[model samples]
Target: MSLIQTDENIIAQMDSYMQRVSELAPQIYKRRPVACVNTFGCQQNVSDSEKIKGMLKKMGYTFTDEPIDADFVLFNTCAVRGHAEERVFGNIGTTKQLKRERKETVVAVCGCMAQQEHICDRIRKSYPYVDLVFGTHVTHRLPEFLYKRLTGSGRIFEISNDNNEIIEGMPLSRDGKIKGWLPIMYGCDNFCTYCIVPYVRGRERSRASADIIAEAKQMIADGFKEIMLLGQNVNSYGKGLDEDINFSKLLRKINALPGDFRIRFMTSHPKDCTRELIDTVAECEKVERHLHLPFQSGSNRILKQMNRRYTREDYLELISYAKKRIPEVSFTSDVIVGFPGETYEDFLETLDLVKQVGFASLFTFIYSKRNGTPAAQMPDPISREEKGKWFSELLKVQEQISRAKNADLVGREFTVLCDSTAGEGRLSGKTLSFAEIEFEGNENLIGKFLKVRIDKFTNLLQGSVIE
Candidate 1:
């Protein structure tokens, strides 16, 4: 089957979603509207915020960085960690004071946090001042929700926890014109013992491969030079689909598209990091040479407890294979410092694995007990103090490794996508290997690709543009 074929019903719904936005535009523009959206969480939430901004902009809303200055204020939230949820509460509380200052200002909250039943109930009872509350599934319903609020319906709540069909053709207001996010699939089926994603985000649902390819083509046409395909686990891209196309095939199709743009994807589970996918990354020139494969804990005992379905040996083998195929490939990973019942030896194993892998970087986190997850009920005997110490030690080791790895790039010339200008005559962009660098360049270099030579390393790689 060809890549262009998709379910007619799904396409029709996308058209309907866009049509509703168009219809709501005139009514929304009747009054001048300024919006401020504070996005919290992963790239998926960022992508959702972009669509929200697009719909709001289409309805004649301009943006303000200050939430107090906006006629409409929205929080695209995250529920992945306790700290993020706390920040959401803190920000939402501030909005209540803002509402008192500007009685006409609309305060709304949406995303993964809003999808939780307890979170919805708490907001309804305590945060009565919130104008609208919705979930991830019904993001396209913002226009309808706003219409209800404007017509004096008071507080609006529209949260759907179902694994709803993917809504395509929604308007997008990307953060950058040159770099974009394209979601190949939604939700996760991998219910890792420590995760709440499968519960809140629902099960896996892949968009038609054709739809993804078409989006990439359009992104290129729109002058995007980089596209990152997003998912909870991109390696499982086509499992639920009827089509024969898998992640590797999809990558090949996007790589073949007519464009000078670079391609990247993220959050691969070690269990699903197939041989074909690894080889495909090495083979595709447009694909970035960096992979973010999360090995939460290096102890096989902890891995089994977390239900990761892969052992330390398995993960090491995969990394070894990738490095063998592409010698210069850099790897980054996520590690949770204090998973329930993790022993000191388990933590040591993690440090040992860090040394063995020599990762470019690590996103380390203290294990936060999500209420409904299996690990929450497990024996979490580890104290906060111990977790803090372990976290610090782990970070110390990873930082040293990262510094050494970056130092190795000191004399290298890399093609950097000139993204923006930093203060004091510095231009900043990222290498194809995802090394962020600050270099001296003209302001006009923003949004263009340029070669840069690495000269020094500090907080970020300091460099100069090679003429």
Candidate 2:
């Protein structure tokens, strides 16, 4: 079968659960109204929510931000971290209160968290008021799920199956018109002990190169200036290729597409980051100079315990590669404090690494044990107060480094594309290095890249337009 047909078949199978619901409920009644979708977790989840919105809009439902004002409430949730799952549970409980207050409103929950068997069982048992529960693969089936629920032929339905298919031809209502999100890969195969993404999102799968390139070309045709590639682990892209065309090759291909579009990718694993990938990133003019390489922990002991498969020395070498080839390269790292047996020395190792690398920014967090992971079963005896202490220490150091990085931008010109709201008579966009900057400009300057000479940097983003 062709790609589109294969995709449609997978979507059909995912929505098959709704057929059972339809047997009990029926489609005679007709009503369509506004819905609010709450998204949790990473950019991938946000992209999925957009697809859900596109599907709902086709079904004659308007979008609303306020849940109370919306006719239907849907949650596109994440299960990567324990805290995120707790938040989903809390939201579900609150929605139950909403159903009590307003019996007519329909409540639905979908996304990765819905793929968990235990979570699914609880939602079916305790929250019978929920109209539907769907998973990652069935985003295109929202219409069918809603059709059965509204027509009085079906009760609640849930779809939580292991699916690996790429869907196309759905309308996309993007969050930002200037910067588009392009998915090159999905799911994770690494299965790090501290992560639940592998279990919920399933194995790694790469989209066909032709399909991805075509989609990106259309985005460029529509005047999008920037494209951020989305994936669980992007370095593993093109592993599905027969001739071994990797992400670096993809970068070169997209860069030579005869457009001025800027390229960016997120959440790279230090393990899969290879010499070829480094060289491509360093040399490709179209690829941005910033990298988001996530080094979860700094201590070799803790890293081994977490099954990260890389030592601190290995990470330093990767940093060395970037430093020599792309001297001005800025990097952002993910740091987790208070893992199961993290000690004072371990925390110091993290601090030392952060200082050694002088990261552009750090997404620091206190570890929250995910349920199904091996790390969760390990003794997490660290107190909340201790975790907070470690987190505060990490934050203080990262903030200083970030402030210095931003401050150094002063007396330099950066190419920024206008996107978000700027102050009165001003525009806000990101530097090619991903630094957020605020600058004043006439309305005509919007949507186009302009050279802004940084007049001031409060260690906060403030730029002045060149006269």
Candidate 3:
């Protein structure tokens, strides 16, 4: 709804800076620059940080473990929860001392929080030690921004509101060797009443289907065993694209690719998750059996108030359909308790839904109002104490369900790609259904998918690898 304001003159200047960096590449290579990126929030922010690392690596800047030791420090931030914002401010405040210690250090802040105009203005007034402030849209131009800071003087603020630009073939520094996050789409069109995503992330725009398929093939070739398609709403993948493709078609194509890897996706809205999509997921051998469909509230009244566009009955019907089609499939969902005007009866309805669905796991949160959203302006009659009670109750119910569901898999064997080595001969990985499982194995087993027997359940599902 709100577009980022930028003039042609500023755009030209940015382009010119990039050109100057390229022309002066030989001279710039004398000193090795080190950068440190501290990321917060969701998996999407992690993916963005990987891209930032990639761009910086391309610019001949190596990474550092300590923010204070690095010549350039960047905070890739989040604004979803209030606590995450508070942590960012606290970290940035510490950077004031880091800047004072080394005056030449370039301290920057970017991501969803930086995209907010109000946040940017506040930082400019309060934290002048920050050398640069950018946003989600201009990640590809980090080298240019860095060059301007190095070759010139003063603070730089360039937070672009528009996210429509798609720069392909950007370098990436991924965290895991066996698993990777592939973003099939960018931004959100569904402005949920309590969400700040549409305001910060911009409109929904999907990558070309062919481009996605190509990236999948490349990842497979690069030895990644799993790829989770990341998006705000993955079900609505090819909405405004020129091609007549949709998410179901894309899954079919990816599954058909010759590979031994697993395919997964996240954050599906029950409203946009069509029956065809569920059938496709069931039929695709590579597609995982775990689904993260978020049902914000069970009360139809609260759902209407949030503009979720679906009823409790609709969600249950969809779950019933998916389970019948793929009986082994597991369901996970997000629940927001104590929304504006949520009643005791409404809270009971939510608990009832949790009982009926028996979700493998549920991410429950007490609703926190975000600025510039419809729910923020609504009359929130529910008090913090009442919300806390609801949150605790939801967690108790879901924990019992999760434990019992996991308890069912006590003797079952599932394939696990060893991804991490916990100390003392323990290796951690995940099953095809996205169940976290750790087993006793050596480092040599890392990156290999082996059949593991489910032995126990503690903080996470435990198992022993079978030859």
Candidate 4:
């Protein structure tokens, strides 16, 4: 079979699987089967799980939060960090007893972690109770895999290589009603030495702009208050497409859509970020005034080692331009404190960059090595103890910066989308700049936009609705 299946062919195949599952489900399941899908990783994984749940729902499965009460359990895994993988394994191990108690219960593992050969081998040998194992490429074939598992096809595993196809029209059972995740592109072409996303997610391929715009319109009509455009690196979107479009052009199209919703995207590659993109954000009122550009490392030498393709100076230049264009722009970034072969001086460079940026918040990591990545094979003299200390130091510095940033917002009023309840009578939401604030309100205010006045900051910004 060809690697890239046509969308019509895949859709037809899925329809067949849906029919077969419907036929088999009545015979096998006494009542509606309850599925517990535990997603671990990025928003991409969460979006993938939504589609998985959509398929399971078509197969007559009701959802549950508890695995013990579930007739089907799926672990949508992550390969970003070793700690994440370990947590997935630990969670999977807990299901062994559930499988023992309910022998008919189906256990499946899928996603980036399952795409790895070693992870599959380990699951096959160590966790024999897992009935179905598929990879990132074959997520669209979940119904087929589940059908085979149900029809006495013992322990199915389908981890095919990347086909570089963009499959659309898959049903989705989203987790939220207020916010929606719309993936504009998939996979990464950059292949930073310390990362495993390109290896597992395959090559970069963007969804056609028309499809994306249609989805955005539907999201707006569905009353979605915010639409988060997802990608491995969103700035690299519109590559490999036939249209004369790029990320900025795409944003303009979406921003032109009639809606009260806000636009947001993430993990923008600093190497690919451009003046046009920054200008687009400044001009587009719908796009949030926040950029989550991951610099990874501040030292040019360390950046060269990691193959991040941009220096601290280049990153700062982009930041400078963004700030000039949008004065209220809030920035968040990902930083690695202790990369391989990084010295104390290199660490200081990272800290210096953090202070210079004054990010609203930061997501810091201590550099977890992945097996297939080039950084894993590099020489590392830094001890785990030393890395831990450096990690703490970075966190302390960032906390001070974060507190100061939040402090500046005090007594200021901003419009925020109330998305969730905080405590009993309190509610939590995010400002246009992406800073979260908690305010006192009833549950009726959950999905509505409200004006909130920041009163104080203690860990989080405490506020009151300006009624």
Best by lDDT: 4
Report the lDDT tens digits of candidate 2 across residue range 50-99: 77776665555677888877678999998877777888888877787777
lDDT of each candidate versus the true structure: 0.87, 0.81, 0.86, 0.91
Residues forming the 10-long window of minimal summed lDDT in candidate 2: 21-30
lDDT of 3: 0.86
**Residue range 1-467, candidate 1, lDDT tens digits:** 22223346654554554456456534654555788999999999998999999888776678989998887899999999998899899999998888887776789999999988899899999988898999887887787777667657868887876535777676778888888999998889899999988887887888888788888998999999999999999999897677898999999999999878899998799999998998999999899989999999999999999999999999999999999987479999999989999999999999999999999999999999999999999998989999999999999999999998888899899999888889888899998888889999779898888989999998779998886
Model 3's TM-score against the true structure: 0.94
**Candidate 2 lDDT (Cα, 0 to 1):** 0.81
Cα error, candidate 3, residue 10 (Å): 14
Report lDDT (Cα) of residue 220, candidate 4. Answer: 93
Instruction: Give the per-residue lDDT digits (tens) of candidate 3, residues 177-265.
Output: 88899998888999889999888888887888887899899899999999889999999998777788899999999999997899999
Highest TM-score against the true fold, candidate: 4
Tell how far residue 339 is off in model 1, in angstroms: 0.4
Name the runs in model 2 displaced over 4 angstroms.
1-5, 8-32, 97-104
Q: List RMSD in Å for every model shown.
A: 2.7, 3.4, 3.4, 1.7
- What is the clash count for each candidate, in the order shown? 0, 6, 0, 0
**lDDT for position 114 in model 4:** 96
Question: Which residue pairs in candidate 1 collide?
Answer: none
